[model samples]
Target: MNINSIKIATVTAGYVAGVWVLCSIAVVIAPDTLRYISGAMMHLDLSQWDWEMGMDTFVVGLLAWSFFSWVTVWCIVTLYQYSLRSFS
Candidate 1:
């Protein structure tokens, strides 16, 4: 089956944006929990690190991450389509 790269990328980007919004809210509501989770993921101590989120940083991060996710998914889908055509 062929996949629509644009649609799939948009959906993936939307999903990532939603997660980013939730994470931003989580950071405001439960920063310590986020810090702990981040620390665990990184396998390092982040308790003493300063957690700062400015409006500019948040907006930039949201845009950057969403765009990055969209591009990544688009590329993957395009590659998959190419591989399917190549193999069959």
Candidate 2:
């Protein structure tokens, strides 16, 4: 991709990562909310449920996905630029 395309992709990935991080905060503060939404759509009580493998996993996954996406996009951009400079 060209520099412009890389810039756009990196910016979009960063924005998505920021949003994901923000939403992940809710899981830390209110783990039960995730259970209600994920376990069932009927607002089922999940206080008895384990947060380590369930809600915690979801939160960690989101944060990890966000970070990975942003990093990957940036890496692609760097590689593209390097290839251009090396080949030309």
Clashes of each: 0, 0
Q: Which ten residues in a row have the lowest lDDT in candidate 1?
A: 49-58
Candidate 1 TM-score to native = 0.96
| Candidate RMSDs in order | 0.7, 6.9
lDDT of 1: 0.94
**Most lDDT-accurate candidate:** 1
RMSD of 2: 6.9
What do the candidate models score in CA lDDT, each in turn?
A: 0.94, 0.72
Which structure among the candidates has the greatest TM-score?
1
Give lDDT tens digits, candidate 1, residues 13-84. 999999998898899899999999999999999999977877887898899999999999999999999999
Candidate 2: misplaced stretches above 4 Å?
Answer: 1-3, 40-49, 53-64, 67-88
